[model samples]
Target: MVSSIAQFQIKPIGAELHLFGIDISFNNSALFMIIATILVSAFLTQSVKSSYTIPNRIQSLAEMTYEFTTKIVSENVGIEGMAYFPLIFSLFMFILAGNLLGILPYAYTFTSQIIVTFAISIAIFLGITVIAIIKHGTKFFRFFLPSGTPVYMAPLLIPIEILSYLSRPISLSVRLFANMVAGHTMMKVFGGFVISLGAAGFVPLLFLVALTAFEVLVAVLQAYVFTIITCIYLSDALYLH
Candidate 1:
């Protein structure tokens, strides 16, 4: 049987200067993130530089991405949430590229790693917390209090709210990490069956092909879900609730 758990092999590319007692070893995940960043930057710059009034292919792609993200933010958070377009759009592109790139044979899947997803989720958590505090000031604490709750229940409800708020990062990170890892593992398992069964494996092989297509759709959909959730969080922060 094929192993569903991927090996977390830590290959040391190089070690940076140690900070205090901590040594930082760069690895494949770092490399893929750098590549993803460069790809996103290049694509955006090229698309914008070749701008056309009537919209060419690259321009249309860029516009479509913008409109897609704008619609999500607008519908979920309303017009006042438009200020978050850049962050939402960047998140969507980076994640979409990372997920899609990982679909390629032998490419590293960064999103499958907990560290990467945790970093992203934590950043979103912090950004929302800061925005809430800044926009609502000390009144942000009121997010915990239910509108119709009895004044006596405030003590009980506030802690629950605090717990829920604190759990956002955990929930966000796990959702993406679990989905990416599970789908890829399933794909790998089915793919192995095709190889092992040889010519007689045509049925399983056909199913594997279909699953590949589904995984591709999932890659895009998960990216969208992550981005839209981010917008919703931002909206909650900005509008308080």
Candidate 2:
């Protein structure tokens, strides 16, 4: 029987390449990331190109996603945040596509990797930090200090708030990675049981189908949650709340 944990292993898929002493080898995770990017680009492009006065299914989906992302930005960051809508929109669709793609049998789930998720989270975290610093100048430092902070608690409060702020990437990355890994690993174990148990495996098989549907919901929800967090971060940067 194949080990359920083996599914999460990262193995090279092609001849390895090294650039400036760095390993840039292609792998299943990379392939799926490329595929996700291509598919997302194609879907959005086609949806826009074929859009009509009376929208069809694809057009409607495309428009709804657009409007949904727009609302997230406008509500969170106000008009000032509209400038970042493209970034937020791309993030939502990319994550949504990655999650759904991994649900397919034998497809590599890029978002399941902690490195990928952490990279995204950190990039957003850093970008928003830069935005706050650039826009607010030295006033950005006031975030850690916060309004109404007591004078006697400066040392304790400052460190605690700074630590909490730094934990954002860790929480964001782990949440996505842990959910995808747990859900997929459970599904794989049940799948293996179906093969091993033969006729009696129908019980696990039914549960597996239900789990797949649930995972799909999780995929969309995770994307939405991530985007919402992003908008919230931007709002804090813009409003210093």
Candidate 3:
């Protein structure tokens, strides 16, 4: 059991020196995030430097990523919001790489941690709020009052909108964190069964393999869902509908 737990747990890569009595631990998640950032930066740099009119492998990959995000933004947020392509693209790639990297053996899933997901969700929420307020000034508060809402119901509709708006971060963070943690935990449990039962555990092992593939798909899908919701939120800010 101890071995199984060890197999599933993430280990620290290094520790930061304490400053002002605040201890900061740097771990595998931090290492993987650095790796993910480097990978993204390198890929984009290489693709741009190549400048191949015919398109090579790296260029093809870069184009695909650009097209995917562009399509999503255009469809969901419209042309006016195209300026946000970089933010949406980076968010998708970062989460996608973090998720896919975590699926590797002995890798840490940062997205499974509530702290990371909450940080991301909170950032997105605040960014959209700032954009809306900057664009609309004090009038942005009018968003809480739905169009065509009866004047007498302003007392009721306002609170409902406020509650729904406040719930965004909670819902966004939980959806990603819960899915990643639950899927990885179940995979680890089944994998342990396969190891302990040895050759006789072929059935569980096969199921584990199937679950791994499914988890890979889930990781990609979750990243897409996260990015799409971001675009939707941006749309709400841009159009206020």
Candidate 4:
């Protein structure tokens, strides 16, 4: 049986190439990311290509997802948030697709990598910060300290608030990375048991099946959690208090 951790390794697919000083060789993680992007693109685009008065399965699913994302943005960030709906929707679908695709046989789960999740989280964090700065100017810094506090409390409260704000990317990244890694690792361990036990593996096989369904739910839930938190951050940026 293949080692469970071996599945997460980033082995180059072909000739490894160096661009300047960076290692730019294509690998499994990159390949799976591309696949996820293509799949999401096709699903979103094709689902609405031929809109019928009474939507078909694909169209219905697409419309439902669109409406769901709209509601999320509206509730979390208000009507003005609709301007950012495309970004929010794309982020949700891409992460969801990546999580779901990783469940397939021999598929790589890039989201399991802390570096990958951290990178995405950092980008979102930076973008939100920029938006806040642009919209509120110097007042954006006030987010680190709540209003109505005493002047004497500034010394203690500012540092704590600053630390909390800086930890956003780390917390967001770790949450997704931890969940994906834990769920996938457990499934892999159980899968190994199923293989080794042969005929007696029926028990573990059943568990693996249930675990898989749970993972799927997790995949969707994590996507929602990540997106909603982003919306909340966006709301904070748009309206400081």
Candidate 5:
């Protein structure tokens, strides 16, 4: 019987490549990330191959995805945020692909790992902050300090706001990581039950099926939540409100 947590272990596929102290060898996590990226790229490519006045199924899906991301950015960040539509959309689709693909049997779920999600979160946070800095210059500091604040309240509120802003990536990354890990780990446990219980495992087998479907919904929803929060953060940066 395999341990439920065993599935989360990272195993290298081939030669362990350690260049300059960095373990850059290809592993299950890397393989799945590659697969997710390729899948998203291929899907979008095929989805938009034919552009017609009347929408085909593939075109419709592609168009829907485009409009969905556009709406997310437009609504949250307004017109100026449209400049980042492609960025926000790519992030959404990438995470969405990772979440969905990980649901497959025997597939590696990198998003379950905090490192992967944290890296993405950090990148997004940095990019948004950089944009704010570039666009607003010194006024970017005003983000943590609201205008018309009493001198007494400035010190108290400023530190709290700063901490909250700094914790954005941590909170954002952990939410996805925790969700994926919890859901996948539960499924693994149920799967183990089905295998070990023999004929009597039918109950758990049924549960496993339902859990798998629920994970699919979670996969999409997590992607949406992350993207929306990012949009909100971007909007705050742009508008400083």
Candidate 6:
């Protein structure tokens, strides 16, 4: 049986290249990421290319996604957050596309890699930190200690609060990476059973169908979770809450 983890391997394609000692050669992960980006771009552009009073399926889907993201930002980050709508929207769509693309046969799920997810999460975390510092100046550090906390509790509470704050990116990235890895691994296991068991594989084949459907739901849900949490973080930075 093929190793379940083999599907996640990062095999380089074509010629390899290095820039300043860093290996920047394109690989399966990079190729699928590009595919996801192109697919998202094409879908969004085609969905909105023509206007209609009674929108078609594609337009309706695009509109619904737009409204959903708008509401998320409005409710989580308030009016000031509207300025970053484009960034939030792009993040949501890109992640959603990447997750869905990974569901296809032989496609690499870039989001499944902890490094990729962590890099994205850390960048967002740093950006939010910078925004908060710029907006509130020295007051940004005040967030490490809640306003109503007792002075006597400062010694204990400060460290806990700081640890939690610093762990945000780790938690965020791990959540996505873990879910993708677990779901894909389970699917692979069941697929092997389907092939190996032959006629008796019907049981696993049935389960595989159900698992695939669930994975699709997970793909959409994870993207929303990631985006909404990002909105909440941005809100905290904007309001120092």
TM-score of each: 0.90, 0.96, 0.92, 0.96, 0.95, 0.98
- For model 3, the superposed segments whose C-alpha errors exceed 4 Å read 2-10
What Cα-based lDDT does every candidate model obtain? 0.84, 0.91, 0.88, 0.91, 0.93, 0.94
Regions of model 2 farther than 4 Å from truth: none
Encode model 5's per-residue lDDT on 1-241: one tens digit a residue: 8889898999999998999999899999999999999988887887777556787887788789889999899999899999888899999998999999899988998899999999999998999899899989999999898888898999899999999999999999999999999999899899999999999999999999899999999999999999999999999889887
> Where is the poorest 10-residue window by lDDT in model 2?
44-53
TM-score of 3: 0.92
Error of 1 at 239 (Å): 1.0
What does candidate 4's lDDT look like per residue over 4-117, in tens digits?
787788989998889998999999999999999988789888788755688989889988988999999999999878999999998888888889998898899888889999
Worst 10 residues of 4 by lDDT: 44-53
The TM-score measured for candidate 4 stands at: 0.96
lDDT by residue (161-189, candidate 3, tens digit) is 99999999889999988889888888888
What lDDT would candidate 2 get against the real structure? 0.91
- lDDT-best of 1 and 2: 2
Per-candidate alpha-carbon RMSD to the true structure = 2.1, 1.1, 1.9, 1.2, 1.4, 0.8
Output the worst ten-in-a-row residue range by lDDT, candidate 1.
2-11
* 24-94: candidate 1 lDDT, tens digit per residue: 66777777888999988887778777445678788788778888988998998888887877888889999
C-alpha-based local distance difference test score of model 5: 0.93
Residue pairs with clashing backbones, model 6: none
Candidate 6 Cα deviation (angstroms), residue 39 = 0.6
Clashes of 3: 0
Cα lDDT tens digits, model 2, 115-220, are 9999999999999999999989999888998789789989999999899999988998888889899989999999999999999999999999999999999989
Residue runs of model 5 more than 4 Å from their true location after superposition: none
Superposed by TM-score, candidate 2 places the C-alpha of residue 87 at a distance from the truth, in angstroms, of 0.7
